[model samples]
Target: MSKDSSQSFLLSDSAMQAASYSTYQNFQSSPTLCASELQNWKQRIGLFQTHLQTTATPTQGSLFDTTSTQTSLDSIKPFELRRQNTEFWRWQFDDVGVPAMYFVIDYIATAQKGPILLYIGETVKSNQRWKGVHDCKRYLTNYQQAHRDTGLKSELAIAFWPQAPADRPARQKLESQLIYKWRSPFNKENWRYWNTPFITGKEP
Candidate 1:
């Protein structure tokens, strides 16, 4: 062949070889791509099987298991009042007379911790205020005295969780749970339970 024709033929051959090598590489990689796709499909199937098994299994304590309505924490409504306020007294005399769980909170202590649950109690009668001069009240009185003497910040507050008039037992149970959770200082029942010292302005 002439010199130019020979160069053109060599270029065409090189291009053909490159195209063949590219096709060979793609062919070699095809199995790996198929394997990866198959693995992904297997994982998806496994997940689908797990989901089916979970859906088919019966869960204990499901809402539908009981004929009676179950009360959840979300169902409990909370109300707050300053212990010294007239509104606190008025709330006791509310005409509905619902059972309630009450919490004596030190709002000042709450500034350090979350709401300092000083004491917890429940009453069947809405009108009852710590059952007319209880140990809880005495504790509060002593704390107030310390506040006056030492100029300690004392912002005592009360919170109530009123439930249906007939749900006194539930209210009491909730009160016990709150006392256990908060380890309230003045609660006689929790005195032996938490065994933790009271966080008060006074040492003892």
Candidate 2:
């Protein structure tokens, strides 16, 4: 389940620029004056998706292997992925929850090809996982806000994997598998696959 960077699929100069230093804003205008730079990031991600769809192959790695991820997503019924307004932290049950794996995805991109898996993680306490300060929360907010500001729609939501292993290490291993398989952008392991522009860090 280890997909390393040994594969030799190269992105275009623009995409590379977006993925590396994230120099898009240098030649682009801000979506909002004091807002996080996410609109441009979304545009860059869309370009990456379009290019990868026609060019990606099995040997190239699972970073853009949408077919498998799409199939996996299809297996999960719509009812499985739950949503409870913007402040999703409240979705937890009675302050206690079973250990599980969670997925953050956006459904609005289905018309283009398929839904986007933005992030994945395993938690011993599913309900408490998103209850407090979480970096992914900020990332998701930036993502959804960017869409709203740019006049686009994004059906963002979270879904738990019912078969997640109760063991923490096993859960984490499975979590990593999904993250690499789907190339979820918000996950740090996947930042190399995409620019991760929503987050403020040393990397692009």
Candidate 3:
């Protein structure tokens, strides 16, 4: 086998072993949530769970793979941006108020920088979020058609807090807070990373 392939095998083996060890340790040290905390988490789940149920009805195929409904690239100018798709990947890491994990699109000059566009949004469901991204991509295309000088690319980064507790309310609140807090070059208000708004759903 080639040297690259051999190295990949070694790395894969190491990752598997590390994961196995981590799982064993977690199984040994599980903690229980207090009653009050659990109740709050349940409430948050109920509100956002509806978004999931509504979107789950099925619309189109995988948004990332198909171009049938995708926006064309020739229209919009590409913007310099970066995306961060982060996931906790561990149930034990989840905390009640804090986001268990997130996929962030940081619009800056970073190693992960990619194309950019206008208006970014976050969703609880992965597929729905991806569809949102597709829409952004299309928007970028249309934008280029409208203003050729803008020269920005619309990009999407999908992250999930799968490790987050299944309690829908807590997860929704966490995600909304994260989005509210998210900071990017394109972020107009600069609300995230500061005392902006909670999940009040009201304009701050």
Candidate 4:
């Protein structure tokens, strides 16, 4: 037989013998192979070890490596609330050059606790805050009327977080997470207080 074919037959025979001795005790008690076959087996084992070592050592810039993974994570900036205002409408328009998510909060004095999140929303154009005013104005008016009728001391304010301009999906994801975390009453999906005025046709 050719040299390569002879080597393959020797390796296959060694593997079959190893498999036949199923248990660890059986494998240890099995008779040793001839010197030539034993040398071939040792050489194959050394080659496998070298292959395993090469594969286990990560090459630089590998996508699955720790350094590359950490660099990807570091690229993402944390979301932070940049501006807050009680009269968001009165705030002058400035092109922030980023998409933004905003929160409508109510400072309820009667509750004697911190501000309560009323609604969460996002906008692709940060300067075009007016585009969202219709819903904000309506909710605020209804909230004020309802509070007035019940004699609860409350004031509305908006908080904003500007995010990188191209990430509209990220902004929306953040909005959903915040809505779920705060359980905002006016958010339609988290409609805990959907029966509140202006939402349930109880406009004041």
User: Could you tell me which 10 consecutive residues in candidate 1 have the lowest summed lDDT?
Assistant: 22-31
Residue 32's lDDT within candidate 2 is 49
> For model 3, how does the per-residue alpha-carbon lDDT over 1-204 read when each residue is reduced to its tens digit?
344322221113333334432111111111233444423332343333234333422223332233431222111112222222211122222122222333433232122322222233433333223321232333223222322233322223323333333466656543343333222212233324222221112111
Model 3 global lDDT (CA atoms, 0 to 1): 0.29
Q: Which candidate is the best by lDDT?
A: 2
List the global CA lDDT of all models. Answer: 0.43, 0.54, 0.29, 0.45
The predicted structure with the larger lDDT, 1 or 3, is: 1
Score candidate 4 by TM-score against the native: 0.50
Best by TM-score: 2
TM-score for each candidate, following the candidate numbering: 0.49, 0.59, 0.27, 0.50
Our tally of clashes for model 1 stands at: 0
List where candidate 2 sits over 4 angstroms from the true fold.
1-86, 201-204
| Model 1 per-residue lDDT tens digits across residues 8-111 | 21113333334331110111111112334433332443343234333422223432234332234324323243233312442223243346566676555422
Q: How high is the lDDT of residue 104 in model 3?
A: 37
Segments of candidate 4 deviating more than 4 angstroms: 1-83, 90-97, 192-198, 201-204
Candidate 3: regions farther than 4 A off: 1-148, 152-156, 183-204
Sort by TM-score, best first.
Answer: 2, 4, 1, 3
lDDT of 4 by residue, 49-131 (tens): 23433343233343233664434323322222332443433334333324656666654422323345567777765445644
Q: CA RMSD for every model? A: 34.8, 13.7, 21.2, 34.0
